[model samples]
Target: MNADRAETVAILALGWLASNDELGPVFLGSTGASAEDMRRGATDPAFLASVLEFLTMDDAWVTAFCDATGVGYDEPLRARYTLPGAEQVHWT
Candidate 1:
């Protein structure tokens, strides 16, 4: 992953962690279950695609959501949504 993608992934991981437990979103207004959703998303492309789709709409949460769901990364969990994409955010 490039710097931008890597950064995006880091923030997302934070957001994903925030989704867990009674904590306020990893970033804010976090929709609980990013972690669970990611877990389900993994080994389940359909679910992953759904999550990516869900994120595309939520500009504010994309970062935290990704942070909370750091499935394809190697970083310690810190409850805080981090992914915040620019206007050019998109999924494939």
Candidate 2:
């Protein structure tokens, strides 16, 4: 759950999706993210977390991304929570 490592994995996952012509367009369209946004997000932990969250939205996409990047499917779940400000708040 290291934030640095999570950000790296998130970037790699985004790159994996971007490499696909079909999925790339879909991802960009769905996120409304341009190339500039992706570049900026590469250095932003919060934005990277959002990327991981976006990827986790689809089971099929998650499987494909994991297979392509050799990252475990559960990695995204761990990553999103690891990002700064992502901690769960529990009030009892």
Candidate 3:
């Protein structure tokens, strides 16, 4: 995914997370981001990358977000790597 498409996916994921009552607080707590912070972070690629990181941590979250957003299940991970600080690690 290109940066723009990745950002769009991240934004979709953010919207999904925001509307999820159960996961919304969990995300905020995990990231230490307040509602205000999230609002402000929407346009920040690094912050959006964090959002993708949080979503990709759990398969269920990924599935739910993908399902809700009508995106492919693998899109979040692809989008994450395209963002600011999500380079894939190699242990070879």
Candidate 4:
């Protein structure tokens, strides 16, 4: 039961950043090695931990985003996007 509407988180994140016009180049990864680096970083909880270390979002924001789009924060950072209660069986 991978989230019915996956990719929603990333799209919203990017869209929100774009809307703010503050999407610094520093927050993004290029398509080749940078992309690879991001993916790699995602898997290293410590790395992802560092990447998200500064976020100051409220749970309300996450809830609102999910409510607004009917999705979960299941976007694949480095991990497979699994639905709220699923076993994450698809990507293996």
Q: What is the TM-score of each candidate against the true structure?
A: 0.33, 0.84, 0.93, 0.30
lDDT of 4 by residue, 1-92 (tens): 32322333444443443333333243553222244555555344333433322121445444544455554454333222231322446866
| Segments in model 1 whose C-alpha atoms lie over 4 Å from true places | 1-38, 66-92
Clashes of 4: 0
What is the Cα-based lDDT of residue 89 in candidate 3?
78
In model 4, pairs of residues that clash are none
Model 2 TM-score, all chains together: 0.84
Query: Once superposed on the true structure, which residue ranges of model 2 sit more than 4 Å away at CA?
Result: 89-92
Residue-level lDDT tens digits of model 2 in 1-92: 68777988899977876677887787788889897887788888877887888888889988888888898878888888888767778998
lDDT of 1 by residue, 12-77 (tens): 543454354543343234444545555554444333333444444454444445454644323212
Model 4 segments more than 4 A misplaced: 1-24, 28-33, 57-92
- lDDT of model number 3: 0.92
- For model 1 the local lDDT of residue 57 reads 47
lDDT tens digits by residue: candidate 3, 1-92:
89999999999988889889999999999989999988888999999999999999999999988888799998999999999886767999
Query: Which candidate would rank higher by TM-score, 1 or 4?
Result: 1
For model 3 the TM-score comes to: 0.93
Q: Pick the candidate with the highest TM-score.
A: 3
RMSD for each model, in Å, please?
A: 9.7, 1.9, 1.6, 9.3
Q: What is the C-alpha local distance difference test score of each model? A: 0.40, 0.82, 0.92, 0.38
